[model samples]
Target: MPNLRCCSSSSLSLPAESYIYQLCAAGPASLAAISSDNSLRRFDRSSLALLPDGLVKETHAAGVSSLCAAGDGLLATCGKDGTVKLWDARRAGAVAVFQADKGMPLLSLACNASSHSIVAGTELVKPDAFVLFWDTRSPGKTCRQYVESHNDDVTEIQFHPSRPSVLLSGSTDGLVNIYDTTVPEEEDALVQVVKHSSIHHAGFMQDKAVYALSHDEMFSIHPVTSADEDDSHADEVKAVEFGDVRPVLKAEYVVQVLVDAAGSYVASGRTSDRSLSLTPLVHTPEFHFEQSNSWMLPGAHGEEVVRSVLFDSESRTVYTCGEDGHVRLWKEEPASSAELSSIRPTKQRKEKGYKPY
Candidate 1:
């Protein structure tokens, strides 16, 4: 990967001092973000200027917890208020709300445009937790819900990049469950489960392989046989466990393993040196991280945790948001003759995989 350098930084003036929680490419030229201040806003992707009619204050009664692209230039956000709202960036307020029968805080969300579907995972409420589904065409009522797969708050939910009905959910209960939503029965819906510890982020990476990152930084990748079918069993799927990534990445914490146009990259931060590293996940021949291919950015957010990282392929720039309440952009530093000569193409090694034990 190219050595990324900080180019520009922008700050969003929310109602109060609040952390920028999530960032997503809203449309062609706009970047959408949600915050702890219970608001949603858009900014120019190039200049990082706040766009006109782009600010929507108090999007949720409490605070927005998650944001995801809902297709057709729309954005979806859910919050402690327990409802999912769809937004058209050109407008000021939510266009529609996906309501749940019981108002429970939602923690994670995922949407599929091809299937006209949206899924939201709720925080554990007494005896039950839920993964509610709604058809984008009809947002007034939830269409389906899975109540038995997870016993704790669902921290992440993602659909197969190409297979919408194939869903993945990870939770505080240390289980990452894969389900075929087309299977109406809750028991039958759950086809696979991978064990972990309090998952912070889990999703479909390249080739639809499932990666689960725990809150304490335990990372692992579970491979699937094929993407065409969703019945792959968890017992058969051996996980390549990389326990406690803080040592491997030489960092204080692992932020997220985000997949962009290129592939999945692990974002990590080292507070002692105040640096951030993006290690590319190479899975072509096998699964491994090319640390030599990592792009390091020093003075990263000044000791604050970076929450989200977005790589724009068109501009070839990196955008990162953090607890510092700022969105910073980084571009490739012009390589010197010595630096250019030192750069050699890295290859994925056929390393042995670790079981999820």
Candidate 2:
């Protein structure tokens, strides 16, 4: 268990109706956030202070839905406007825009630096939903499209942090699909799919597992590789259920799930009286999650939803964004022996089965 406490907080004086939907860390010292007002804002990571003159007014025609920190000081964002735009962290204007067909709203986005590719997931239209890809060097035109990959709107897409050719997508249709982007054909590109009840978000846990959050507030962790190399178990992937099934963190609504950089803990942004809850990946021999911990900022988002959370491993600091249009920073407080003991598992966690290390 780790000590957690809010050290500071800040926000712009936007209309009460404005809400922050997404957050991405540009680097150790800077963060980029997107809001319901169709604006993109930059903040100083340490102070949680809005940078002077660091606002991009109305970057999108509609509310921005997704954002990612693309390498090389670039941030990628997409919106209901059916456009994907990239912004240089050092400037105020967009550097590139990738347009989609009419009525196709971009719902999710991901960028792979090694492959120099940017992918956007679009809303479900009459014909079908699509996963659009573009080469960062040639952004005006789409390089390829994966049609019929998802039957419903794609809610999340993420590239494998270390594997350039691998990608993951989660949809409202309750399916988590993995794609081998090197494959040219849409049908052949899909390598695997993990079914859930209704996925709210999905992402790779390092490179070994895919973790998904359901709309029902339940979560599951599945192996990234299929059980059988023969392809017989293609549709029968196994998963370890948590949350509702095991009752790890008592959260009302989980806005986002994040894996710490060191992979020691999994944090969830809980809304409706916003707070950040953490669960230790290490478990006791009884196969139960350790006693979890949570932290709430002093005047935090006041009943608003926490949309996203970012953990800085080097500094051991936490950054969070919420529907209240504020970005808050939290740091670990020195823990006393009694406080430390209370957070540890009643029994020592076995290093044997499913150790995150």
RMSD of each: 5.7, 6.9
Evaluate residue 161 in candidate 1 and report its C-alpha lDDT on the 0 to 100 scale. 75
**What TM-score does model 1 achieve against the real structure?**
0.90
Cα distance off (Å), candidate 2, residue 310: 0.8
Model 2 spans > 4 angstroms off: 1-3, 226-238, 243-247, 268-274, 283-288, 292-300, 334-357
Model 2: how far residue 102 lies from native, Å: 2.9
lDDT of each residue in 1-357, candidate 1, tens digit only: 456678778886665456788899899888988876777889998888888888888888877889999899999999888899999866667899988777888989999999999999989997888888999888787999999888899889998877677889889889999887878898987878888899888987644478889888889988744334444543444568889888888888777886755566788887667788887777545567778778787788786667788877556677888777888888778772223222222331011121111
Question: For model 1, what is the error of residue 50's alpha carbon versus the real structure, in angstroms, after optimal superposition?
Answer: 0.7
Q: What is the lDDT for 203 in model 1? A: 84
| Model 1: per-residue Cα lDDT at residue 14 | 66
Tens-digit lDDT track of model 2 for 255-348 = 5656544553445443444455655554332223454444334334566666677767666667777766677777656662323224333333
Q: Candidate 1, clashing residue pairs?
A: none
